[model samples]
Target: MTEDQSALKTLSEVVRDRRLQLGLSTRALAQRCIDPGTGKAIPRHYIQRLEDDLANLAPPRLPELSALAAGLELPLAVIQEAAGFQFHGVTTRHSESGRARMFVARFDELDPAEQDRVLAMLEAYTAVKPPKVD
Candidate 1:
């Protein structure tokens, strides 16, 4: 399998395993993924297909992936990276207080495609902006 496919397979395994660990049915998971703004739940069949690796839905839009992460209660960054979002440089440093410092990018520093996906997710999460008070 190609590198991307291999990564996706790993992701599929993670999703299935985590779901089982949480004692959630496929339909339950889908229900958890309901978009607050849209009130749309990801279909149970799609989740099943994803877990079975019968679905080629990798590199999904960031909004969709974030919703999945919300339903799964997994780290968004972990899911995002597993979904093939390119990350920027990572660095670890030590401070005078003996604390470790880890640096990572949240959304910026990704490739254009990944950036667009993240932007879409942000938009979805903040569908209604607060009223401006000048």
Candidate 2:
């Protein structure tokens, strides 16, 4: 396979790994995409093709990726990374201290309303730092 195809295969593997880690069957995941207005389920075959890497679904369309991320309760960035795309703005530091400080600073940089929304989201999804004791 060409490099691009290999990369796509790796990305597909990542998606499959994440899906399995989340314990979602292809059919179950498709059901999560049910259209609210129509109440029609997304076809299971579409999901199966995606998981099997049999379809050209790598670099999945944004709306579908967003739905899968929501259904998996995963951060969009994590999903994007799994899909072989890196988010540009988020910084990654080598040291844990630097990482923590950067995270806090990034957290602070948001507007107050956005900060509240982000904090609420973080609380709902993953563990956050407790207030410093000392």
Candidate 3:
């Protein structure tokens, strides 16, 4: 596969991983996308296609992303990261143990719950911590 295709694959994997982590089935996520104002829903098959990487839906509109993040009860940054597009100024580092360490070294982008989840996962997976000094 070409570099772009490889990147897209990585992006797709990220989304799938995060979606699973959030405990959302594709159909449930699709239902969450219903347009409140118009009472219309984006089709479940379309969502399945997107998650399965059979189709690359374009970057979601702001409102759509917002509603999705809200429904998933996750920060937009988390969704965006899973979607493989980081917002400006977010940096990520991977520890020696292979745990992803994200540094929002700019703004306090993630809410407390998201932070807790991330930290808990990191601790569970890698037991990461600063080395003790003499």
Model 3 Cα lDDT, one tens digit per residue, 31-87: 776544455566677666666665436655545555455556666555555455422
The C-alpha stretches of model 1 lying farther than 4 A from their native spots are 1-9, 35-40, 85-134
RMSD of 2: 9.9
lDDT of 1 by residue, 1-134 (tens): 45434444255666788899999999999889765445667788878877876634544565666677778888665556555522222222335664322123444336689888878987987997888899
Candidate 1: worst-modelled 10 consecutive residues by lDDT: 85-94
Ten contiguous residues with the weakest lDDT in model 2: 85-94
TM-score of candidate 2 versus the correct structure, residues matched by position: 0.46
**Per-candidate local distance difference test:** 0.64, 0.58, 0.56
Candidate 3 achieves a global lDDT of: 0.56
The TM-scores of all predictions, comma-separated, are 0.54, 0.46, 0.43
Angstrom error of the Cα, residue 55, model 2: value is 6.5
lDDT of 2 by residue, 1-134 (tens): 44444443233465567668878887777777543334555567766776676645544555665566566666554555455432222222335556764566466446689999988988876676668788
Two-way lDDT contest, 2 vs 3, winner: 2
What does candidate 1 score in Cα RMSD to the true structure?
12.5
Top-scoring candidate (lDDT):
1
RMSD (Å) per prediction: 12.5, 9.9, 9.9
